[model samples]
Target: MPNKKTPTIWAIGDVQGCCDALQELLNHPEIKEDEHAQFWFAGDLINRGPHSLKTLRTIMQLGERAVCVLGNHDLHLLAVYAGIRRENKSDTIDEILQAPDVEEIIHWLRHRPLAHFDQNHLMVHAGVMAKWDEKKTLKLAAEVSDALQSKHWQKYLQKMYGNEPNRWRDSLTGSKRRRVIINALTRMRMCFEDGSMEFGSKDSPFDNKSNDIMPWFELPNRKTEKTTIIFGHWSTLGLMIRKNLIALDTGCVWGGKLSAIRLSDRKLVQVECTGKRR
Candidate 1:
């Protein structure tokens, strides 16, 4: 008998509806070369690129071979589908919203977890809170996931738009708590030293910054510091590979490369984008 091939897991950066770029990255010699490959997407699978429908379909078709966490854009798509929010001018998700399989696709996307952990790697679309250990992070993530899959999910989406109560607190309750969890897991880029999220900074970390705001991952004495955290929401921060954190959003929708990193060996594979979103 032939030797059983070990599964090779690839954590890919945000695709953001750039299906062509995703396909190109998948076909790269490093990725396609592995017959037993699995993919973990960092999220924002749709919006602001050339092909939202194809992107969602392709990832949906992956079934057991792919794991996706929800990102801000993903939630926006769900909000629009639920009639809780209007489509933005930059959104390219109309194809997905109008598809024959729209219901099925939305169901799949809505059910996706806010965080996923496997083999000691914690994956979220954005940063996990400094106060959350691996177990707490997973637990808090489930709270939002439950809300999204609940019958009253539309009600939750209706109240999901603001940035109020920007810090996490154990005493937080109801939709406010879920909203904070969703924002931290899907949209956070920077935070204050106390782990309260900072919404105003989107520039790369290389840019000048006040001492008061630091990247969420860099918060002092983070609880999840020991676990390897994989995230993708900050496209401007690009690809940052550190001892315990990976930031993989290389801005494929903005004409940057689509990136993927192999889990076992940390090999990097990338495909350059052909055009910027108009």
Candidate 2:
């Protein structure tokens, strides 16, 4: 019996393989399937961690009940496996590429939303640009989502392997334009004090080498600060619990734990991920 309260939806962080941990987390005693429950995954379903094939299969089985956004890693898997991206030994997309249901998996993955999760909160693989107000962010997300779904999607994916547009502007051009939007929705980590998106700072939050920069959540004039955000992809930031944001990547591939949070009441759920990127 589905509950009339719209089913307690939980948003989970990156699961770079870590299938065992994912099973454990989903099977947690508190998450009762008997009740109406839904889940939203922040993305990065494959690569780095082991058993990506198993992980993708599991997520696919969940069907419409699960809402997942596209993460950089997930995109990497699709691009490489599809021959649009170069193969890196660090990623585990081969397993997924060689999987029996590869067609369905990639099709579904490519079609996943780049951003705009739900009403109260915006879901993304990584943090949003502190500069992009909700309106701009939504518009950018729509653009990328459109490109990914178009027949020229592979062209966009091939052109996606870069860090050129380090900052956002209203007048960027060509691939630069798409890259800025892509980076913001996918690879962004930190931002300068003035809100310029920083593409290279992957250190722990304490090591703020640049006094002018801070994590997206730590930015000063965040317009979306009032709107809750659910994001993954910052394994370095790990699981940070705050009123306005929820950082869900627990670094599962780096031997950290996989985290899931029930959005209805914000209950904590977790799985222990144990697999090296190699």
Q: Which stretches of candidate 2 lie over 4 Å from their true place?
A: 1-4
Segments of candidate 1 deviating more than 4 angstroms: 1-6
Indicate the worst ten consecutive residues by lDDT in candidate 1.
269-278
Q: Write the per-residue lDDT of candidate 2 for residues 1-278, one digit (tens) a residue.
A: 87657667878898878788888878888875634577788988878777889998888888887788988888888778658768787877787777788888878888888886575888988878777777778888888888888887888777787887678788986678888888878888888877778777887778776687788778888888888989998888889889978999989889888888888778898776766667
Per residue, candidate 1 scores C-alpha lDDT tens digits across 1-278 of 99977688999999998999988888898788876699999989989998889998888888888999999999999999999889988889898888998999988998999999998899999989888999999999999899899888888888887898899999999879988998899989999988999899999977935998998988888999989999999988999998888889999899999999998889999999875684
Residue 121 local lDDT, model 2: 84
Compare the candidates by TM-score and give the number of the best one.
1
Tell me the lDDT of model 2 at 58: 88
Candidate 2 versus the native: TM-score? 0.93
Report how far residue 128 has shifted in candidate 2, in Å.
1.0
Q: What is the lDDT of residue 83 in candidate 1?
A: 92
